[model samples]
Target chain A: MIKPWLRIALAGNANVGKSVIFNQLTSLNQIVGNWPGKTVERAEGTLFFKGYTIRIIDLPGIYSLSTFSMDEIVSRDYIAVEKPDIIINVVDASALERNLYFTLQLLELGASIVIDLNQIDFAAKKGIRIDVEKLSEALGVPVVPTVAITGSGINELLSTVITVTSGERKLKPLKVRYGKEIEKRVQAIEKLISTKLPQLCTVYPARWVAIKLLERDTDVAGKLKNYKNGKEILDYAEKLATELEKIHGEPSPVVIASERYGLANKIAKEVTAIEAPPRISLEQKLDAITTHKILGYPILTVAVVSMFALIFVGGNFLSAGLEFLFENLSMFIEWGLSTFLPRIVVDLINNGILAGVVAGITIALPYIVPFYIILALLEDSGYLPRAAFLMDNLMHKIGLHGKAFIPLMLGYGCSVPAALAAG
Target chain B: MQSGSRGSSKRRNPRGIKGVISLISLREGEKGVMAYAVGGFGLVRRLAEMGLTPSVEVKLLRKGPFHGPVQIEVRGVGLALGYDVASKVFVRPLKAKLDD
Candidate 1:
């Protein structure tokens, strides 16, 4: 009997430890690069489990499926076109409401999903006890609580994936219900699309297409224009959207997004019991200070400067030791070659091969590896977002968000290391 | 720009959120429940995705001294909404009965 292949995608919001879970599952041989012409990075890796080869892709971290950003576009296209066997939404248990908002979108897409509730320990510390079974039942999917850093609940997540993919377990993901005003329009557009343009559903969920139409998502809206009856669908969508706007006293997308959040919040409140007031922890206090208006700038400057100083100082020391060791190694190789070969061969050994290897090992690797580690450490400790939060106003002035700061700074150094560190 | 939208009709006049006051009116550390994110669809979606839904309580964490962008805490996450974006959202003060 031949083993079948299973394709999985790790989807989540940023800082939910999606990358950590990806690293734990795939381990090595991961290919990392940008999504052709786009600056945002793409990561893919492969592994074998239970005699089945599994290909895992770490999609870009995005807050929503709306095409407001490149990350959202790339992720949605992949899910719609490629259609992976299972999508694992690695959510921060502590931030259920926000994380669940994204999960609600995935469910709307009708994806075969397994929820990996990462960072459950932190949530527990916050006096949040999530009833895993109840959450699973509510979302109508398997819910696996995991501390990705510790590799807990990973096996259960894997097994659940197999069951869901192999048809042993059936999943009926909960679909979010928008209020009557929006729902009525969704039904009308859904009917039009099905009757006139059924092929659209082949690419995207029919109702999802209607919702996107109502929300005036440019990417989806632009694509629909090319199809027959697309004009009618768009016009109807626009009219319905306008009515929705008037009814809610907001835009159509806002109404849709709020409805989604309403569902997420309701679900979160139901499945989790807050045993204590989620008070500000020490980390939260420090996080606040790091982004404080009066003190944040100085702290940010000192933190970045200190980080680079440590990297330079530590890299210098490591490089010095490595340089000393490799120099002797190259000398020994040259001597060994000189005893048996001509001068030219010894020169080649000394200047050509040994030089290249020594330069890479003793110089580049020493600095790049440690610097990348420290940068990742800062990012993982949740400092980057805080720094971004503090510098948001400044970045906003430049027509960018605070999240752009890290990438902008990374460009000053080698772009490769920056991509490795940030991507 | 005035925080409230000119196009959309008000569903219900919020009692908690000042009737006409926008998010800019809130002081630091003042917490209130969101009434509406009044703006274009794109802008509203951006804020809603950050958990700034109607009736959801939020805290004004900080803002730069020079009338800069504001940082807010919503759904246990801290975010910095630009001045333009911040002003578009309206909020009512959190009431004791709506603590949940």
Candidate 2:
């Protein structure tokens, strides 16, 4: 059977194993960084599955579809504009309420999606039990429980994806409705958009554009600027927003956000039950010490010092080992070539091209590989946030947040991911 | 006590309801319910997107030393907010009634 190429974007909150799932599905060497916003840009990989080619896009972790951050804008534009065939809404099951907040926003955009309920093991450990069938019914989307790191439930996730894409499984997504007050204005703006700006409606769901207008999203507002009667719609949106502000006594955006959170909280409460009392795990205990007011700084100092020291000692050892191997290989190659070619030619080939390649591998890979491994370990173990929590105030002295330390430390190993992190 | 700290009335209790204080004012381990953020629309939306919307329970899990960011737990998620950002998110502390 012939199948057309399908594009699926994996999106959710930061550090919720989207990249891990991306790696699982596409077998791509995506940096599975632990920190939020680690995947600054969208990473794409293709998988040939059961005769169908699927394009998987791993979007940066975002809390909401709001245009406050670069990651949000990139992910939002890609989903709304590019219109991927299926969006894998990867929710961290451990933090269902918070993760669902983003999931709700994606639903509002009217994109076809399946909830990759990633990190179910973590939730179970935390004593949180989710009714998967109920959650799927509530959201009106297929919910697949997955442990991306262990490659569990990944095959089921793919089969479900193919079924949904093939139209074998029909989805009736529940529309995200807000409070009556907000809903009234949303309908008014949505009608105005559909009738006046039909072209914009094609690009974005009319209702989504209307809701964004109600939130006074500058990005959505900017998109409307190109169309005729755009100014009139903006004025109408602004006027309605002011009226909403009057009733809520807060900004329009906040009011809309509160409503979205309200919905997310409701769904989370409905589908999740506490099966067991949460026990303080070793991870929490470690977090306590590493982020302790007094002890944290000392631990951080030792961690930082030891990381660099290991890199130095390990890199040197590996470098020497590789250099020795290359030296022997170079001698063998030169001897074999000199028997046939001129001595000068053999020397040039051995000393120039081969030597350059060997030197790069021996010097760079030895240091870079160790640095990345240690960095990944620090991130994967969830120690980086604790380190950031400790350094927050001191980092303020330099006019950067404590989170800035991650990129600064990353700069030592390589400047590229560090620069991306900083951005 | 409130008189000395009074500045922009708009930034003050946005709803004119008393007994709310900045989230940063809570000591480590203290709990509060989110009230409202006082900064621009961007900050309020950003905080809410992180699940810090009004009426949600929050606990100050840790405070960085030397006037740094405050780590707060909301909706079972831990978030570190810089001093400037945390100060704008006013919350009604659970201890306020006891103190009063």
Candidate 3:
């Protein structure tokens, strides 16, 4: 009963409600796994709608498509190579301009895009009004204003996904105009690529390859160099980039970035208007005490200590319960076998493989489950950054940040199981 | 519109510290708008690509006395950056008005 499936990718910055939207769309139909040999988490889910079986892939949360991190490389490569039928760029309405920067980059790769203008509720509360239709027109993509937490606009987003991918709706993905000098060089490079390495043009947009080449993006360069004449194409791009840098008096990457931001800012201003901002709200008030210069560190200490205590106590409880349950089971087996079986057979079953299995279950699962719960809680509730902000100085003293400390603490907690294994 | 405003403001400042402060210099609870991220070409590009730009607002959530990495909130998201990188990121303290 397997039907042909259309693939959709939900791509967005962290805290922009991408996961919430994914949760709403998939709703317990997700398989949380990891990319092969990568520690980065991957989530895939399936949705059946209107006689079509669509598979949705939630790419890693990333701010940009640059190869500055593994997540970025994984995300961008998937979109480029896999060529998902549609890319739903989940944008934070409250942070429209910054989010749009990523959307624009997606467009450069020539993917069919549907802008999920998420968190409209937060934006409206902050007195930011967006003309959704106007933004859609500006970006040449269907922009759906959504409160993903409540499932608002989810249907519209889905329908748009269907229509756009099915080619029922024809739209032009907006291209960033990086002015004459830069565009000229890009064209020259694109021509070189299309002529010499025409096969690459099929995989990636010729102009994007040219642009990435000029910016010297490592991941793209790595891929390009493996091609038939990628080195010559890269050298040509390097020459053009140097020439542009000479004229601009700044690095080509910087020059390219300024243009992108400049365009994003301009587009944002055109479609947004402010109503009246609300009074100083709950998050700010909480931050005042939890992030205050005097009170922040104390609060940070208590939170971490309490988290450790809770995990230690909870893990110990689970550990003891499992140990007791397994001890009785193991003893019962040994007794049952000893009554009728040979002594050697009974001892081997009791002390060898059974012991190893019993040791693993009792020792590992308890600590691992609780530690993950605390980690996910901190990560999801938006407290890790605050903790990092609070502990930056203290952490820096030990050559780590608050982010690095969390995993290190998890490792230390695992020592509990290691201790049990030793016994 | 943004470029015009920046030009007018720059003309009046001359030598005034119009909006130039390192990311690390920001105190707790103070928010500013990112203006320029200066460093080697690679660093500037990476920072910009990561959403540190002229328009986004950044708030210092926590920091240490000196030579400590700075934690900041930008566009309602948190990020921790080292002292060296933070020092190179120049942000302008938000004025009485909300720019966004």
DockQ values per model: 0.44, 0.70, 0.31
Error of 3 at B95 (Å): 7.3
- Measured by DockQ, the strongest candidate is 2
List pairs with backbone clashes in candidate 3: none
Where is model 1 more than 4 Å wrong at Cα?
A: A34-40, A278-280, A293-377, A384-423, B1-18, B38-40, B64-69, B95-100
Off by over 4 Å in 2: A29-40, A315-369, A399-423, B1-16, B96-100
DockQ of 1: 0.44
Model 3 clash count equals: 0
lDDT per residue as tens, model 1, A242-289: 988898777778788888888888899999898978777898799678
How do these models rank on DockQ, best leading? 2, 1, 3
Writing each residue's lDDT as its tens digit, candidate 2 over A188-301 gives 999998999898888899999999999999999998999888999999999999999999888888888888888888999999999878777888898889888799889998
Q: What interface root-mean-square deviation (Å) does model 2 yield?
A: 1.2
Q: What share of the true interface contacts does each candidate keep?
A: 0.61, 0.86, 0.39
Cα lDDT of model 3 by residue, A9-119, tens digit: 999988798999999999999999997778788999999988789899999988788887889888988899899999999999988877888888999988889999999
Best by TM-score: 2
Instruction: Identify the leading candidate in terms of lDDT.
Output: 2
